[model samples]
Target: MKQQVRELFPTPLWVLDIPPSDAAPFNAKLRDEIEKIISPRPNVPSGSNWQTPHDLHTRPAFADFTKLVEISARSVAQFLNVERYPMMITGCWANINPPSAYHPTHNHPNNYLSGVYYVAVPEAGPDLIFQDPRPSLIMPWTGKLSPLTANASAEQAVPGRMIIFPSWLRHHVPSNEGTSERISISFNLMFRNFAETAASPRWKATAGQE
Candidate 1:
Protein backbone atom coordinates (compact mmCIF):
# COMPACT_ATOMS: atom_id res chain seq x y z
CA MET A 1 0.00 0.00 0.00
CA LYS A 2 1.14 3.53 -0.75
CA GLN A 3 0.17 6.77 0.89
CA GLN A 4 0.89 10.42 0.12
CA VAL A 5 2.37 13.05 2.38
CA ARG A 6 0.89 16.50 2.36
CA GLU A 7 3.17 19.32 3.43
CA LEU A 8 1.46 22.46 4.67
CA PHE A 9 2.34 25.92 5.87
CA PRO A 10 5.68 26.25 4.17
CA THR A 11 7.98 29.18 4.84
CA PRO A 12 9.40 31.33 2.08
CA LEU A 13 13.07 32.22 1.66
CA TRP A 14 14.19 34.14 -1.40
CA VAL A 15 17.77 34.04 -2.58
CA LEU A 16 19.19 36.27 -5.29
CA ASP A 17 22.69 35.99 -6.71
CA ILE A 18 24.36 38.81 -8.61
CA PRO A 19 26.85 38.21 -11.37
CA PRO A 20 30.44 38.19 -10.12
CA SER A 21 31.66 40.82 -12.61
CA ASP A 22 29.07 43.28 -11.46
CA ALA A 23 29.10 42.24 -7.81
CA ALA A 24 32.85 42.70 -7.50
CA PRO A 25 32.89 46.46 -8.01
CA PHE A 26 29.53 46.92 -6.38
CA ASN A 27 30.64 45.15 -3.23
CA ALA A 28 33.86 47.11 -3.17
CA LYS A 29 31.94 50.37 -3.20
CA LEU A 30 29.60 49.16 -0.51
CA ARG A 31 32.49 48.00 1.63
CA ASP A 32 34.09 51.41 1.39
CA GLU A 33 30.90 53.20 2.30
CA ILE A 34 30.24 50.89 5.22
CA GLU A 35 33.74 51.28 6.57
CA LYS A 36 33.41 55.04 6.42
CA ILE A 37 30.27 54.98 8.54
CA ILE A 38 31.61 52.56 11.12
CA SER A 39 35.21 53.67 11.34
CA PRO A 40 36.56 53.78 14.87
CA ARG A 41 33.87 51.21 15.49
CA PRO A 42 32.34 51.16 18.91
CA ASN A 43 33.51 48.69 21.49
CA VAL A 44 31.37 45.63 22.15
CA PRO A 45 31.41 42.41 24.11
CA SER A 46 33.82 39.66 23.11
CA GLY A 47 31.15 37.73 21.22
CA SER A 48 29.16 40.67 19.92
CA ASN A 49 29.32 42.25 16.46
CA TRP A 50 29.38 45.90 15.43
CA GLN A 51 26.31 47.33 13.72
CA THR A 52 25.85 50.60 11.89
CA PRO A 53 22.93 52.93 12.46
CA HIS A 54 19.60 51.59 11.15
CA ASP A 55 19.07 54.52 8.78
CA LEU A 56 21.45 53.54 5.98
CA HIS A 57 18.63 53.62 3.43
CA THR A 58 18.27 57.34 4.02
CA ARG A 59 21.94 58.11 3.38
CA PRO A 60 22.87 59.43 -0.04
CA ALA A 61 25.82 57.05 -0.25
CA PHE A 62 23.46 54.09 -0.09
CA ALA A 63 20.75 55.32 -2.43
CA ASP A 64 21.61 52.82 -5.12
CA PHE A 65 21.61 49.92 -2.70
CA THR A 66 18.31 51.11 -1.28
CA LYS A 67 16.80 51.19 -4.74
CA LEU A 68 17.97 47.65 -5.40
CA VAL A 69 16.34 46.52 -2.21
CA GLU A 70 13.07 48.19 -3.16
CA ILE A 71 13.04 46.49 -6.55
CA SER A 72 13.65 43.10 -5.00
CA ALA A 73 11.00 43.70 -2.34
CA ARG A 74 8.45 44.43 -5.03
CA SER A 75 9.11 41.05 -6.55
CA VAL A 76 8.57 39.41 -3.21
CA ALA A 77 5.34 41.31 -2.75
CA GLN A 78 4.17 40.20 -6.13
CA PHE A 79 4.93 36.58 -5.35
CA LEU A 80 2.94 36.84 -2.16
CA ASN A 81 0.03 38.50 -3.97
CA VAL A 82 0.12 41.58 -1.75
CA GLU A 83 1.38 44.14 -4.21
CA ARG A 84 -1.43 46.57 -3.70
CA TYR A 85 0.12 48.10 -0.59
CA PRO A 86 3.52 49.70 -1.00
CA MET A 87 6.49 48.41 0.92
CA MET A 88 9.13 50.61 2.53
CA ILE A 89 12.39 49.99 4.23
CA THR A 90 12.04 50.65 7.91
CA GLY A 91 15.61 49.88 8.97
CA CYS A 92 18.85 49.10 7.13
CA TRP A 93 22.23 48.55 8.75
CA ALA A 94 25.60 46.94 8.26
CA ASN A 95 27.08 44.27 10.51
CA ILE A 96 30.80 43.90 11.08
CA ASN A 97 31.41 40.63 12.86
CA PRO A 98 34.95 40.06 13.93
CA PRO A 99 36.52 36.73 14.72
CA SER A 100 34.39 34.88 17.28
CA ALA A 101 31.61 37.47 16.99
CA TYR A 102 28.04 36.31 16.48
CA HIS A 103 24.43 37.44 16.56
CA PRO A 104 21.80 36.10 18.92
CA THR A 105 18.54 34.54 17.79
CA HIS A 106 15.90 37.18 17.21
CA ASN A 107 13.11 38.31 14.95
CA HIS A 108 12.11 41.64 13.45
CA PRO A 109 8.88 42.90 14.94
CA ASN A 110 6.44 45.32 13.32
CA ASN A 111 7.81 44.52 9.89
CA TYR A 112 6.61 42.34 7.02
CA LEU A 113 9.97 41.10 5.79
CA SER A 114 13.68 41.09 6.63
CA GLY A 115 16.76 40.40 4.55
CA VAL A 116 20.55 40.34 4.46
CA TYR A 117 23.08 41.08 1.75
CA TYR A 118 26.67 39.96 2.05
CA VAL A 119 29.36 42.44 1.08
CA ALA A 120 32.39 40.50 2.33
CA VAL A 121 32.95 36.97 3.51
CA PRO A 122 36.08 35.38 4.79
CA GLU A 123 37.77 32.42 3.10
CA ALA A 124 35.84 30.28 5.52
CA GLY A 125 32.37 31.79 5.41
CA PRO A 126 29.88 31.99 8.25
CA ASP A 127 26.40 30.50 8.39
CA LEU A 128 23.04 32.18 8.91
CA ILE A 129 20.73 29.84 10.82
CA PHE A 130 16.96 30.10 10.76
CA GLN A 131 15.07 28.18 13.43
CA ASP A 132 11.77 26.42 13.04
CA PRO A 133 9.02 28.57 14.49
CA ARG A 134 6.73 25.75 15.57
CA PRO A 135 7.29 25.35 19.29
CA SER A 136 5.44 22.07 19.69
CA LEU A 137 7.35 19.96 17.22
CA ILE A 138 7.98 16.45 18.46
CA MET A 139 10.22 15.21 15.71
CA PRO A 140 12.25 12.19 16.59
CA TRP A 141 15.99 12.06 16.21
CA THR A 142 17.21 10.97 12.77
CA GLY A 143 20.67 9.75 11.90
CA LYS A 144 20.83 12.25 9.04
CA LEU A 145 19.43 15.70 8.43
CA SER A 146 16.69 16.35 5.89
CA PRO A 147 14.12 19.06 5.29
CA LEU A 148 11.44 17.07 7.14
CA THR A 149 13.64 16.19 10.10
CA ALA A 150 15.64 19.36 10.56
CA ASN A 151 14.51 21.91 13.08
CA ALA A 152 16.80 24.57 11.67
CA SER A 153 18.40 25.44 8.35
CA ALA A 154 21.87 26.92 7.87
CA GLU A 155 22.45 29.17 4.89
CA GLN A 156 26.06 29.72 3.90
CA ALA A 157 27.07 33.33 3.55
CA VAL A 158 28.63 34.38 0.27
CA PRO A 159 29.46 37.76 -1.18
CA GLY A 160 26.89 39.15 -3.66
CA ARG A 161 24.19 36.90 -2.24
CA MET A 162 21.02 38.27 -0.72
CA ILE A 163 18.51 36.33 1.37
CA ILE A 164 15.02 37.50 2.17
CA PHE A 165 12.48 35.98 4.55
CA PRO A 166 9.55 36.76 6.77
CA SER A 167 10.35 39.40 9.35
CA TRP A 168 9.02 37.27 12.19
CA LEU A 169 11.23 34.29 11.37
CA ARG A 170 13.78 33.77 14.14
CA HIS A 171 17.38 33.57 12.96
CA HIS A 172 20.96 34.06 14.09
CA VAL A 173 24.48 34.28 12.74
CA PRO A 174 27.12 31.86 13.90
CA SER A 175 30.49 33.01 15.24
CA ASN A 176 32.98 34.19 12.67
CA GLU A 177 35.55 31.44 13.06
CA GLY A 178 37.58 32.69 10.11
CA THR A 179 40.75 34.72 10.49
CA SER A 180 39.15 37.86 9.02
CA GLU A 181 36.01 39.71 9.87
CA ARG A 182 32.71 39.13 8.05
CA ILE A 183 30.74 42.05 6.61
CA SER A 184 27.04 42.10 5.76
CA ILE A 185 24.08 44.43 5.57
CA SER A 186 20.67 43.63 7.03
CA PHE A 187 17.34 45.39 6.59
CA ASN A 188 13.63 45.24 7.35
CA LEU A 189 10.63 46.21 5.21
CA MET A 190 7.07 46.95 6.10
CA PHE A 191 3.87 47.87 4.32
CA ARG A 192 3.50 51.61 3.88
CA ASN A 193 0.54 53.25 5.60
CA PHE A 194 0.12 49.99 7.50
CA ALA A 195 -2.39 51.28 9.96
CA GLU A 196 -4.53 53.01 7.38
CA THR A 197 -4.41 50.43 4.61
CA ALA A 198 -3.16 46.95 5.39
CA ALA A 199 -4.50 46.48 8.89
CA SER A 200 -8.22 46.66 8.13
CA PRO A 201 -10.41 43.54 8.16
CA ARG A 202 -10.50 41.45 5.00
CA TRP A 203 -13.92 39.94 5.43
CA LYS A 204 -17.04 41.15 3.72
CA ALA A 205 -20.37 40.72 5.53
CA THR A 206 -23.44 39.74 3.57
CA ALA A 207 -26.85 40.94 4.71
CA GLY A 208 -29.58 38.34 5.11
CA GLN A 209 -32.60 38.53 2.75
CA GLU A 210 -35.40 40.56 4.38
Candidate 2:
Protein backbone atom coordinates (compact mmCIF):
# COMPACT_ATOMS: atom_id res chain seq x y z
CA MET A 1 0.00 0.00 0.00
CA LYS A 2 1.12 3.51 -0.78
CA GLN A 3 0.23 6.66 1.19
CA GLN A 4 0.55 10.34 0.40
CA VAL A 5 0.35 13.50 2.44
CA ARG A 6 -1.90 16.33 1.34
CA GLU A 7 -2.03 19.89 2.60
CA LEU A 8 -5.27 21.83 2.94
CA PHE A 9 -6.74 25.09 4.18
CA PRO A 10 -3.80 27.29 3.36
CA THR A 11 -3.70 30.97 4.37
CA PRO A 12 -2.11 33.58 2.14
CA LEU A 13 0.26 36.31 3.29
CA TRP A 14 2.08 38.76 1.03
CA VAL A 15 5.34 40.58 1.71
CA LEU A 16 6.90 43.38 -0.35
CA ASP A 17 10.34 44.83 0.14
CA ILE A 18 11.04 48.38 -1.02
CA PRO A 19 14.64 49.19 -1.89
CA PRO A 20 16.64 51.14 0.68
CA SER A 21 17.16 54.14 -1.60
CA ASP A 22 13.40 54.51 -2.09
CA ALA A 23 12.49 53.65 1.48
CA ALA A 24 14.94 56.03 3.12
CA PRO A 25 13.40 59.23 1.78
CA PHE A 26 9.90 57.99 2.42
CA ASN A 27 10.82 57.09 5.96
CA ALA A 28 12.23 60.54 6.61
CA LYS A 29 9.18 62.26 5.15
CA LEU A 30 6.81 60.02 7.09
CA ARG A 31 8.56 60.64 10.38
CA ASP A 32 8.48 64.37 9.82
CA GLU A 33 4.82 64.34 8.83
CA ILE A 34 3.89 62.20 11.82
CA GLU A 35 5.67 64.56 14.15
CA LYS A 36 3.91 67.60 12.74
CA ILE A 37 0.45 66.06 12.59
CA ILE A 38 -0.05 64.52 15.99
CA SER A 39 1.61 63.56 19.21
CA PRO A 40 1.82 60.01 20.46
CA ARG A 41 -0.89 58.90 22.82
CA PRO A 42 -2.23 55.71 24.44
CA ASN A 43 -4.87 55.16 21.78
CA VAL A 44 -4.55 51.40 21.62
CA PRO A 45 -5.37 49.36 24.71
CA SER A 46 -1.92 47.85 24.68
CA GLY A 47 1.39 49.60 25.21
CA SER A 48 1.85 50.88 21.65
CA ASN A 49 0.88 54.30 20.27
CA TRP A 50 -1.53 54.92 17.39
CA GLN A 51 -1.93 57.98 15.17
CA THR A 52 -5.39 59.51 15.07
CA PRO A 53 -7.98 60.23 12.30
CA HIS A 54 -7.08 56.98 10.45
CA ASP A 55 -7.13 58.84 7.14
CA LEU A 56 -3.47 59.54 6.72
CA HIS A 57 -3.57 58.11 3.21
CA THR A 58 -5.73 61.04 2.11
CA ARG A 59 -3.34 63.72 3.27
CA PRO A 60 -1.28 65.62 0.74
CA ALA A 61 1.90 64.75 2.59
CA PHE A 62 1.15 61.08 2.02
CA ALA A 63 0.39 61.22 -1.70
CA ASP A 64 3.45 59.21 -2.66
CA PHE A 65 2.88 56.76 0.14
CA THR A 66 -0.72 56.35 -0.97
CA LYS A 67 0.41 55.59 -4.50
CA LEU A 68 2.76 52.92 -3.20
CA VAL A 69 -0.11 51.38 -1.25
CA GLU A 70 -2.40 51.44 -4.28
CA ILE A 71 0.17 49.73 -6.46
CA SER A 72 0.87 47.12 -3.81
CA ALA A 73 -2.84 46.51 -3.33
CA ARG A 74 -3.36 46.04 -7.06
CA SER A 75 -0.55 43.52 -7.08
CA VAL A 76 -2.23 41.63 -4.27
CA ALA A 77 -5.54 41.65 -6.15
CA GLN A 78 -3.81 40.37 -9.23
CA PHE A 79 -2.15 37.60 -7.24
CA LEU A 80 -5.58 36.64 -5.90
CA ASN A 81 -6.99 36.84 -9.47
CA VAL A 82 -9.56 39.46 -8.47
CA GLU A 83 -8.33 42.28 -10.67
CA ARG A 84 -11.60 42.62 -12.54
CA TYR A 85 -13.28 44.60 -9.83
CA PRO A 86 -11.79 47.72 -8.23
CA MET A 87 -10.29 47.97 -4.78
CA MET A 88 -9.87 50.96 -2.47
CA ILE A 89 -8.18 51.66 0.81
CA THR A 90 -10.71 52.25 3.58
CA GLY A 91 -8.44 53.41 6.37
CA CYS A 92 -4.79 54.01 7.20
CA TRP A 93 -2.83 54.80 10.33
CA ALA A 94 0.59 54.67 11.90
CA ASN A 95 1.98 52.85 14.89
CA ILE A 96 5.00 53.93 16.93
CA ASN A 97 6.16 51.36 19.40
CA PRO A 98 8.92 52.30 21.77
CA PRO A 99 11.10 50.05 23.81
CA SER A 100 9.06 47.63 25.95
CA ALA A 101 5.88 48.55 24.04
CA TYR A 102 3.63 45.93 22.52
CA HIS A 103 0.32 45.64 20.73
CA PRO A 104 -2.41 43.29 21.93
CA THR A 105 -3.87 40.61 19.67
CA HIS A 106 -6.64 41.94 17.46
CA ASN A 107 -8.27 41.65 14.04
CA HIS A 108 -9.36 44.37 11.63
CA PRO A 109 -13.14 44.53 11.71
CA ASN A 110 -15.29 45.05 8.61
CA ASN A 111 -12.29 45.05 6.30
CA TYR A 112 -11.42 42.54 3.59
CA LEU A 113 -7.64 42.93 3.81
CA SER A 114 -5.15 44.47 6.22
CA GLY A 115 -1.44 45.27 5.99
CA VAL A 116 1.53 46.97 7.60
CA TYR A 117 4.57 48.68 6.12
CA TYR A 118 7.60 49.04 8.30
CA VAL A 119 9.25 52.46 8.15
CA ALA A 120 11.88 51.97 10.80
CA VAL A 121 12.93 48.85 12.61
CA PRO A 122 15.73 48.85 15.13
CA GLU A 123 17.92 45.91 15.91
CA ALA A 124 16.19 43.37 18.17
CA GLY A 125 12.81 44.84 17.36
CA PRO A 126 9.62 42.94 18.10
CA ASP A 127 8.17 40.53 15.60
CA LEU A 128 4.69 40.39 14.10
CA ILE A 129 2.88 37.22 15.23
CA PHE A 130 -0.21 35.52 13.87
CA GLN A 131 -2.32 33.09 15.88
CA ASP A 132 -3.90 29.96 14.50
CA PRO A 133 -7.43 30.71 13.34
CA ARG A 134 -8.66 27.24 14.19
CA PRO A 135 -9.51 26.92 17.87
CA SER A 136 -10.20 23.18 17.88
CA LEU A 137 -6.75 22.24 16.63
CA ILE A 138 -5.11 23.49 19.81
CA MET A 139 -7.65 21.99 22.21
CA PRO A 140 -6.25 18.45 22.22
CA TRP A 141 -2.64 19.06 21.22
CA THR A 142 0.23 18.50 23.56
CA GLY A 143 3.18 17.35 21.51
CA LYS A 144 5.56 19.62 19.61
CA LEU A 145 5.04 20.04 15.88
CA SER A 146 6.03 22.00 12.83
CA PRO A 147 4.40 25.11 11.31
CA LEU A 148 1.52 23.02 10.03
CA THR A 149 0.54 22.18 13.60
CA ALA A 150 1.87 25.22 15.39
CA ASN A 151 -0.46 27.54 17.28
CA ALA A 152 1.31 30.70 16.20
CA SER A 153 3.94 32.02 13.82
CA ALA A 154 6.23 35.05 13.99
CA GLU A 155 7.70 37.27 11.27
CA GLN A 156 10.59 39.57 11.95
CA ALA A 157 10.14 43.28 11.33
CA VAL A 158 12.40 44.66 8.66
CA PRO A 159 12.66 48.22 7.41
CA GLY A 160 11.03 48.80 4.00
CA ARG A 161 9.09 45.54 4.24
CA MET A 162 5.34 45.39 3.88
CA ILE A 163 3.22 42.45 5.02
CA ILE A 164 -0.37 41.86 4.02
CA PHE A 165 -2.77 39.27 5.40
CA PRO A 166 -6.47 38.54 5.75
CA SER A 167 -8.37 41.00 7.88
CA TRP A 168 -9.96 38.20 9.86
CA LEU A 169 -6.60 36.82 10.99
CA ARG A 170 -5.70 37.66 14.56
CA HIS A 171 -2.23 39.13 15.06
CA HIS A 172 -0.13 41.01 17.58
CA VAL A 173 3.26 42.64 17.99
CA PRO A 174 5.49 41.50 20.81
CA SER A 175 7.25 43.92 23.15
CA ASN A 176 10.07 45.86 21.55
CA GLU A 177 13.40 45.37 23.24
CA GLY A 178 15.41 47.77 21.09
CA THR A 179 16.33 51.26 22.29
CA SER A 180 14.71 53.16 19.39
CA GLU A 181 11.11 53.12 18.24
CA ARG A 182 9.69 50.58 15.79
CA ILE A 183 7.56 52.61 13.36
CA SER A 184 5.05 51.16 10.94
CA ILE A 185 2.11 52.25 8.81
CA SER A 186 -0.98 50.04 8.69
CA PHE A 187 -3.98 50.17 6.40
CA ASN A 188 -7.14 48.30 5.36
CA LEU A 189 -8.45 47.63 1.90
CA MET A 190 -11.81 46.52 0.52
CA PHE A 191 -13.24 45.59 -2.85
CA ARG A 192 -15.42 48.14 -4.59
CA ASN A 193 -17.92 47.40 -7.35
CA PHE A 194 -17.51 49.27 -10.58
CA ALA A 195 -21.26 49.84 -10.70
CA GLU A 196 -20.97 52.25 -7.79
CA THR A 197 -19.12 54.74 -9.98
CA ALA A 198 -21.14 57.03 -12.26
CA ALA A 199 -18.24 58.96 -13.81
CA SER A 200 -16.45 56.20 -15.69
CA PRO A 201 -17.85 54.92 -18.99
CA ARG A 202 -15.87 51.71 -18.74
CA TRP A 203 -17.52 51.02 -15.42
CA LYS A 204 -20.93 51.67 -16.93
CA ALA A 205 -20.29 49.12 -19.66
CA THR A 206 -19.26 46.40 -17.19
CA ALA A 207 -21.64 47.31 -14.38
CA GLY A 208 -24.35 44.74 -13.66
CA GLN A 209 -22.82 42.46 -16.29
CA GLU A 210 -20.58 40.50 -13.98
Candidate 3:
Protein backbone atom coordinates (compact mmCIF):
# COMPACT_ATOMS: atom_id res chain seq x y z
CA MET A 1 0.00 0.00 0.00
CA LYS A 2 1.08 3.55 -0.76
CA GLN A 3 0.29 6.57 1.43
CA GLN A 4 0.89 10.27 1.06
CA VAL A 5 0.05 13.51 2.87
CA ARG A 6 -0.72 16.74 1.14
CA GLU A 7 0.05 20.08 2.73
CA LEU A 8 -2.28 22.97 1.95
CA PHE A 9 -2.09 26.73 2.23
CA PRO A 10 1.52 26.86 3.29
CA THR A 11 2.99 30.16 4.50
CA PRO A 12 6.14 31.40 2.79
CA LEU A 13 9.11 32.82 4.68
CA TRP A 14 12.10 33.99 2.66
CA VAL A 15 15.52 34.02 4.23
CA LEU A 16 18.25 36.02 2.52
CA ASP A 17 21.74 35.46 3.85
CA ILE A 18 24.63 37.71 2.91
CA PRO A 19 28.10 36.22 2.67
CA PRO A 20 30.18 36.90 5.76
CA SER A 21 32.99 38.53 3.82
CA ASP A 22 30.64 41.21 2.45
CA ALA A 23 28.26 41.26 5.40
CA ALA A 24 31.00 42.21 7.86
CA PRO A 25 31.64 45.61 6.30
CA PHE A 26 28.04 46.09 5.25
CA ASN A 27 26.68 45.51 8.74
CA ALA A 28 29.34 47.74 10.30
CA LYS A 29 28.31 50.59 8.02
CA LEU A 30 24.66 50.11 8.84
CA ARG A 31 25.31 50.02 12.58
CA ASP A 32 27.29 53.25 12.43
CA GLU A 33 24.62 55.05 10.40
CA ILE A 34 21.89 53.84 12.74
CA GLU A 35 23.74 55.13 15.79
CA LYS A 36 24.20 58.53 14.18
CA ILE A 37 20.46 58.97 13.76
CA ILE A 38 19.54 57.75 17.23
CA SER A 39 22.54 59.02 19.14
CA PRO A 40 21.83 59.38 22.86
CA ARG A 41 19.05 56.91 22.28
CA PRO A 42 15.86 57.87 23.98
CA ASN A 43 15.10 55.85 27.09
CA VAL A 44 12.13 53.55 26.99
CA PRO A 45 10.14 52.00 29.77
CA SER A 46 11.07 48.54 30.97
CA GLY A 47 10.45 45.63 28.60
CA SER A 48 10.29 47.94 25.60
CA ASN A 49 12.77 48.47 22.76
CA TRP A 50 13.79 51.82 21.27
CA GLN A 51 12.73 52.45 17.70
CA THR A 52 14.06 55.06 15.30
CA PRO A 53 11.89 57.36 13.21
CA HIS A 54 9.84 55.55 10.56
CA ASP A 55 11.27 57.48 7.61
CA LEU A 56 14.74 56.02 7.10
CA HIS A 57 13.82 55.37 3.50
CA THR A 58 13.79 59.12 2.86
CA ARG A 59 17.08 59.87 4.57
CA PRO A 60 20.04 60.55 2.31
CA ALA A 61 22.35 58.55 4.54
CA PHE A 62 20.19 55.49 4.09
CA ALA A 63 19.97 55.66 0.31
CA ASP A 64 21.93 52.45 -0.15
CA PHE A 65 19.77 50.63 2.36
CA THR A 66 16.65 51.90 0.65
CA LYS A 67 17.90 50.58 -2.68
CA LEU A 68 18.63 47.19 -1.12
CA VAL A 69 15.13 47.05 0.29
CA GLU A 70 13.61 47.89 -3.06
CA ILE A 71 15.62 45.14 -4.77
CA SER A 72 14.60 42.62 -2.14
CA ALA A 73 10.96 43.65 -2.34
CA ARG A 74 11.04 43.29 -6.08
CA SER A 75 12.46 39.78 -5.75
CA VAL A 76 9.58 38.89 -3.43
CA ALA A 77 7.02 40.39 -5.80
CA GLN A 78 8.54 38.47 -8.66
CA PHE A 79 8.30 35.24 -6.71
CA LEU A 80 4.60 35.88 -6.23
CA ASN A 81 4.26 36.71 -9.95
CA VAL A 82 3.32 40.36 -9.22
CA GLU A 83 6.50 42.03 -10.49
CA ARG A 84 4.56 44.18 -12.94
CA TYR A 85 2.93 46.07 -10.07
CA PRO A 86 5.39 48.38 -8.37
CA MET A 87 5.84 48.04 -4.64
CA MET A 88 6.99 50.84 -2.34
CA ILE A 89 8.28 50.92 1.17
CA THR A 90 5.60 52.19 3.53
CA GLY A 91 7.78 52.37 6.66
CA CYS A 92 11.40 51.78 7.58
CA TRP A 93 12.99 52.05 11.00
CA ALA A 94 15.69 50.71 13.27
CA ASN A 95 14.97 48.81 16.47
CA ILE A 96 17.43 48.76 19.35
CA ASN A 97 16.61 46.05 21.83
CA PRO A 98 18.78 46.21 24.87
CA PRO A 99 19.19 43.39 27.32
CA SER A 100 15.88 42.26 28.81
CA ALA A 101 13.92 44.34 26.30
CA TYR A 102 11.34 42.62 24.13
CA HIS A 103 8.68 43.20 21.53
CA PRO A 104 5.06 42.18 22.03
CA THR A 105 3.12 40.21 19.43
CA HIS A 106 2.04 42.34 16.48
CA ASN A 107 1.44 42.32 12.75
CA HIS A 108 1.92 44.94 10.04
CA PRO A 109 -1.44 46.06 8.72
CA ASN A 110 -2.29 47.43 5.27
CA ASN A 111 0.98 46.21 3.79
CA TYR A 112 1.74 43.44 1.31
CA LEU A 113 5.11 42.32 2.73
CA SER A 114 7.21 42.98 5.85
CA GLY A 115 10.75 42.03 6.83
CA VAL A 116 13.54 42.50 9.34
CA TYR A 117 17.27 42.80 8.73
CA TYR A 118 19.60 42.05 11.57
CA VAL A 119 22.46 44.46 12.15
CA ALA A 120 23.86 43.33 15.47
CA VAL A 121 23.02 40.28 17.53
CA PRO A 122 24.47 39.03 20.77
CA GLU A 123 26.64 35.93 21.00
CA ALA A 124 23.76 33.86 22.31
CA GLY A 125 21.55 34.80 19.32
CA PRO A 126 17.87 35.37 20.09
CA ASP A 127 14.97 34.31 17.90
CA LEU A 128 12.30 35.98 15.80
CA ILE A 129 9.13 33.94 16.12
CA PHE A 130 6.09 33.84 13.87
CA GLN A 131 2.79 32.77 15.40
CA ASP A 132 0.39 30.54 13.56
CA PRO A 133 -2.52 32.64 12.28
CA ARG A 134 -5.09 29.91 12.17
CA PRO A 135 -7.42 30.49 15.11
CA SER A 136 -8.82 26.96 15.39
CA LEU A 137 -5.56 25.11 16.03
CA ILE A 138 -6.52 23.88 19.49
CA MET A 139 -5.27 20.33 19.41
CA PRO A 140 -3.27 18.15 21.78
CA TRP A 141 0.27 16.93 21.21
CA THR A 142 2.54 14.39 22.90
CA GLY A 143 5.70 13.58 20.96
CA LYS A 144 8.11 15.88 19.19
CA LEU A 145 6.53 18.92 17.56
CA SER A 146 6.83 19.04 13.81
CA PRO A 147 5.97 21.94 11.56
CA LEU A 148 2.32 20.96 11.39
CA THR A 149 2.02 20.44 15.15
CA ALA A 150 3.80 23.58 16.24
CA ASN A 151 1.78 26.73 16.81
CA ALA A 152 4.74 29.07 16.56
CA SER A 153 7.91 28.98 14.44
CA ALA A 154 11.24 30.59 15.22
CA GLU A 155 13.92 32.06 12.96
CA GLN A 156 17.24 32.61 14.66
CA ALA A 157 18.67 36.11 14.37
CA VAL A 158 22.03 36.45 12.63
CA PRO A 159 23.83 39.54 11.48
CA GLY A 160 23.31 40.28 7.77
CA ARG A 161 20.30 37.99 7.58
CA MET A 162 16.95 39.19 6.24
CA ILE A 163 13.67 37.40 6.86
CA ILE A 164 10.58 38.34 4.88
CA PHE A 165 7.02 37.19 5.20
CA PRO A 166 3.42 38.23 4.73
CA SER A 167 2.69 41.58 6.36
CA TRP A 168 -0.30 40.27 8.30
CA LEU A 169 1.60 37.38 9.90
CA ARG A 170 1.82 37.95 13.66
CA HIS A 171 5.29 37.69 15.19
CA HIS A 172 7.34 38.88 18.15
CA VAL A 173 10.81 38.95 19.60
CA PRO A 174 11.45 37.37 22.93
CA SER A 175 13.44 39.12 25.69
CA ASN A 176 17.07 39.77 24.93
CA GLU A 177 18.59 37.12 27.13
CA GLY A 178 22.11 37.74 25.83
CA THR A 179 24.31 40.30 27.51
CA SER A 180 24.71 42.48 24.42
CA GLU A 181 21.94 44.46 22.73
CA ARG A 182 20.17 43.37 19.54
CA ILE A 183 19.84 45.84 16.69
CA SER A 184 17.69 45.35 13.62
CA ILE A 185 15.83 47.28 10.95
CA SER A 186 12.19 46.62 10.15
CA PHE A 187 10.33 47.69 7.03
CA ASN A 188 7.10 47.14 5.17
CA LEU A 189 6.25 47.05 1.45
CA MET A 190 2.99 47.54 -0.38
CA PHE A 191 1.89 47.69 -3.97
CA ARG A 192 2.01 51.21 -5.44
CA ASN A 193 -1.41 52.70 -6.20
CA PHE A 194 -2.98 49.59 -4.74
CA ALA A 195 -6.50 51.01 -4.76
CA GLU A 196 -6.22 52.25 -8.31
CA THR A 197 -4.45 49.19 -9.73
CA ALA A 198 -5.11 45.97 -7.83
CA ALA A 199 -8.12 46.74 -5.64
CA SER A 200 -10.69 47.01 -8.44
CA PRO A 201 -13.33 44.31 -8.70
CA ARG A 202 -11.92 41.07 -10.13
CA TRP A 203 -15.10 40.13 -11.94
CA LYS A 204 -16.93 42.59 -14.19
CA ALA A 205 -20.59 42.36 -15.20
CA THR A 206 -21.25 40.91 -18.68
CA ALA A 207 -23.58 43.40 -20.35
CA GLY A 208 -26.50 41.88 -22.36
CA GLN A 209 -25.18 38.33 -21.80
CA GLU A 210 -26.18 35.50 -19.49
Tens digits of per-residue lDDT for model 2, 1-210: 899988877788898998989888879988888777666444555455555579998999989888988999999989988787788899999888877788899999987789999988889978899998877655446587566778888877888889999999999998888888888899999877645643366535555775
Between the candidate structures 1 and 2, which one is better when assessed by TM-score? Answer: 1
Instruction: Provide the TM-score for each candidate, comma-separated.
Output: 0.93, 0.83, 0.94
Candidate with maximal lDDT = 1
Go through the candidates in order and give each one's C-alpha lDDT: 0.92, 0.84, 0.91
RMSD (Cα, Å) of candidate 1? 2.1
Residue pairs in collision within model 1: none
On a 0 to 1 TM-score scale, where does candidate 3 land against the true structure? 0.94
**Model 1, CA-based lDDT:** 0.92
- Judging by TM-score, tell me the better candidate of 2 and 3: 3
